[model samples]
Target: MPRTDKASRLIAAPPARVYAAFVDPDELLAWLPPGDMTGRFDHFDARTGGSYRLTLTYPDAGTGKTTTDSDVVEARFVEVVPGVRVVQAVDFVSDDPAYAGTMIMTWAVAAAESGTRVEIRADNVPDGISAEDHAVGLASSLANLAAHVEN
Candidate 1:
């Protein structure tokens, strides 16, 4: 069954600033998680047809012992409307049984009375990926973004 995860937050920043948060790799690296996991951009072009790859390490959660590994992932920008919306399709590139295929993710920014309302929707997840996992990830990413922009 196809799965979808949706999450939203009211950010005090403007839409443009929030939108730029996704385009810049350095900014993304500052906020995107698995908190301890770090990533390097093989590509960072932010346009339709543009692609990106990143290495993600899953370290021991308790010991903080680091593991060096990478996922040969790829993503294509599906849509981008400055200060309004961004969408992409991304997938894992590994033979490991834990890693699967592609998924569609959409981020929208809408102006509100107080600030911009940011919503992230991940849709069409492959089987075995749960909506709860996506929801937690989205919540964490947004919280990280808020922290980055606020501080």
Candidate 2:
């Protein structure tokens, strides 16, 4: 069984704007990242049973340059709560061999005094994936999301 790592972020944007990021492919393309990588959604249905694919491009970290061309990763929505929550399972296509199986990610959005509080509860992490790494990634991605919505 995979342990779950929960992460929360506060965004200055309202729940609606923050929620829009998950449903709007265009918004997703603008924010999903690790600084060195970015992605574009090929197709996103954003509803339960909906399947989607995103093409990710990673820049060479060593040289801080773009290295790999866009590559695809696919996912399917398991649940959805409009402007509030989403649960999905995602997997990557890897040649590195260490990466395998799908991971489940749940995104919950709540209205707050400042704006929106976004919580991510991720589970089914593959063997090679570390909790620390997931936390960092989720935090960074949330930061990116906050910035995106703020802009």
Candidate 3:
């Protein structure tokens, strides 16, 4: 059976600003990596039917899906709604069967009293990624996003 994971956060920024951070390559690089992982994009085309390739490197060695210290993600933009939502079809670049599949990642933002409420839902998550770890990673990414846009 497939699994789904979700996380949400209240950011101290307007919806447009928060949404911009999601599509801009530089801004995405600043906040998308969870914890100590750092990300760099091989290519980024933020539009419906477009795609991006991102490589995330872990702080520790030998803890990566694609390589010894990195995870390579190949993702396509399934939907892009300005100031509202962005959906991505993601795949992990790995030989492990447990990590082989398309995962749908939906990022939605809405207006709130203080700022914007951002939510992320990942469906059909790979079996190799533990639920607890994914939750933490999602939350961490949200925190990073908040810090990036709230400042």
Candidate 4:
């Protein structure tokens, strides 16, 4: 069965600033990867129907990368609303069969008294990505986002 993972964070920034982090490639590369992973984009277009390919690599040899030391994802923009939300249809590019299939990921940003409330929701997650691990990854990414936008 497919799983769903969700994570929320209260970032010390406005909605537009927080939302820009996802729309801009440089900003996205700055905060999207979890842990010590570094990200590089093959191509990015932040409009509906636009697609991008990104590779996130770990310095070590055995970091969930069997074929290579990088986790690659190809994603298309399903919906993009400035300062509000972004919906992406993502596919993990891996030789590992467990990582196959498409996932729907949503980033929702809302105005708050002090800052913005950002929530990330992923649906139809493949079994390859365990819930526990996904949660940790999401939380880490959110924290990184907070740092990138808040600072």
Name the runs in model 4 displaced over 4 angstroms. none
lDDT of 2: 0.79
Question: What alpha-carbon RMSD in Å does predicted model 2 have with respect to the real structure?
Answer: 3.2
Off by over 4 Å in 1: 61-72, 96-99
- What 10-residue stretch in candidate 3 is worst by lDDT? 1-10
The number of the candidate with the highest lDDT is 3
Q: lDDT tens digits, residues 15-127, model 3?
A: 99999999999999999999999999999999999999999999999989999999999999999998899999999999989999999999999999999999999999999
Candidate 3 lands at a TM-score of 0.99
Model 2 agreement with the true structure over 20-91: per-residue lDDT tens digits: 898888888777775667777778898999989877776653321122454467899999989889999988
Kindly give the stretch of ten consecutive residues in candidate 4 with the minimal lDDT sum: 59-68
Better of 2 and 4 by lDDT: 4
User: lDDT tens digits, residues 1-151, model 4?
Assistant: 8888999999999898999898999999999999999989999999999999999988786765434588889999999988799999999888887888899999999999999999999999988888999999999999999999996
The TM-score measured for candidate 2 stands at: 0.86
Q: What does the lDDT read for residue 142 in candidate 2?
A: 91
lDDT value, candidate 3, whole model: 0.96
TM-score of every prediction relative to native: 0.85, 0.86, 0.99, 0.96
The superposed Cα distance between candidate 4 and the true structure at residue 70, in angstroms, equals 0.6
| lDDT per model vs. reference | 0.74, 0.79, 0.96, 0.91
Please identify model 3 stretches exceeding 4 Å from their true place. none
Which model scores highest in TM-score? 3
